[model samples]
Target: MMDILIHWIREVDTDIRLGRPPLAGEARSESLAVPMMLQCVTHELLTLDPSLGARYRDIQEWSVQKALSHVQVRRMH
Candidate 1:
């Protein structure tokens, strides 16, 4: 199920990038929540079984990068 969800996430991202209308409950624009949730799922999987870390390493890294892309410089008032 995780593999299917991961694949679907990429598909939704592509659809948004290509300007296609989002289906029900799908994001219409880039969202920080997407990668954040993916990262959380990856973390939980690794926590459940450390041995799975190797398999999810790439996914973990990709999620981290995607989350980081949402960061922006902030100015103090």
Candidate 2:
């Protein structure tokens, strides 16, 4: 599952780099993958130490926000 997530992430990143919006199917998959990825990360962090979950969730949230901002900036150009 991690491998598949990574592959999708990379595919999306590549499309962004090339200044192309993802195809409809890819965009749908990405919408699904992001939340699933966050859940997986949260679960793993909880397994390691329950106290880490909130902090890690915040970090993931920030990371996603930053990525979106970057994409928006790219689109402006």
Candidate 3:
């Protein structure tokens, strides 16, 4: 179920935010995959039901921000 997966992802995100250990064998550092996956899932759900966009707007923003945090701005010469 997508709901179950979202719940689990949110739980792990919360744990990571609080500096707590993730599930056994899971990486502690922030992984680009985490937010990317959430964004992908959210996009798919929104595509299925347009009305759900309102409910997931916050998630969309949050995932976008999370994913952006991985970007590095470089000054190349």
Candidate 4:
């Protein structure tokens, strides 16, 4: 579990590094819309049962996509 979490953290850090840094005027408190789900998955796997963690990953993806679409719809209005 620790190994996987470490790997995820590395991937997230790499994503941030490869992506553009935020604009100077932008807020840092608000997270990037896309990777927020990754963060959620990280949190869940950290706390949830190790045996069920893989299933949690599947659930996390579905939940994040649903939430993201809802947010997108609101933004489009």
Candidate 5:
């Protein structure tokens, strides 16, 4: 759930960045991975249909506490 939520966040951010108006092919091409990864995770997680709600619930909790995770990640890496 943590991983998928992180990827979901990346996809949203990437889409906002890459989906800007009037961009050229090269620029749009550079940031393709995030959305693509989002697709993959969406497929993977949704495959477990019934359990996804619980997983997503946890992700929501994590999102609400993201500042703590960001600090931890920055400190570690």
Candidate 6:
């Protein structure tokens, strides 16, 4: 389950990097919405399984930071 969630998160990160729309059913208020979405997903996952929260902390942090950087760059352009 952890592996699956990690893989899905990576895919979402890639979609964000490519400037693609949110995965089919995902709701987004703006184009650069991955960071917020990722944060929410991370929080929910931790809530679901507190034991694995620590294991995913680094990934959640990195992905959110990366998405934020992308948003900043886009805004500057």
Q: Pick the candidate with the highest TM-score.
A: 1
Cα lDDT of model 3 by residue, 1-77, tens digit: 76666666677456434345557887557667877888898899889898998888987897899889889999999
- Once fitted onto the true fold, the runs of candidate 1 whose alpha carbons sit more than 4 angstroms away are 15-20, 23-28, 74-77
Worst 10 residues of 6 by lDDT: 12-21
Clash count, one per candidate: 0, 0, 0, 0, 0, 0
> What C-alpha lDDT values do all the predictions have?
0.76, 0.53, 0.76, 0.53, 0.50, 0.64
Model 3 has a clash total of 0
Clashes of 5: 0
Off by over 4 Å in 3: 1-3, 11-27, 75-77
The TM-score, computed over Cα atoms with residue i paired to residue i, of candidate 2 is: 0.33
lDDT of 6 by residue, 1-77 (tens): 75665675566445544345566877644334655666777788889889978787887887677667655343554
* Model 1 Cα lDDT, one tens digit per residue, 1-77: 98877777776454324345667886546777777888898899888899998888887887888778778979999
| Preferred candidate (TM-score higher): 1 or 4 | 1
Per-residue alpha-carbon lDDT of candidate 2 for residues 1-77, written as tens digits (9 for 90 to 100):
64454445545464323335665666422243454455567577679898876556654674476446435343554
**Candidate 5 ranges beyond 4 A from true positions:** 2-30, 50-77
Ordered by lDDT, highest first, the candidates read: 1, 3, 6, 2, 4, 5
lDDT score, candidate 5: 0.50
Which one wins by TM-score: 2 or 6? 6
Candidate 5 TM-score versus the reference = 0.31
The TM-score-based order of candidates, best leading, equals 1, 3, 6, 2, 4, 5
lDDT of 3: 0.76
How would you encode candidate 5's per-residue C-alpha lDDT over 1-77 as one tens digit per residue?
A: 64755654645554435335644664533343444555455556767685676655654454444423333344554
lDDT (10s digit) by residue, model 4, range 1-77: 74464454345544333355767886544235435655576566758667766755754664465446546443554
Clashes of 1: 0
Instruction: Note each model's CA RMSD in angstroms.
Output: 4.8, 8.7, 4.4, 8.4, 10.5, 7.4
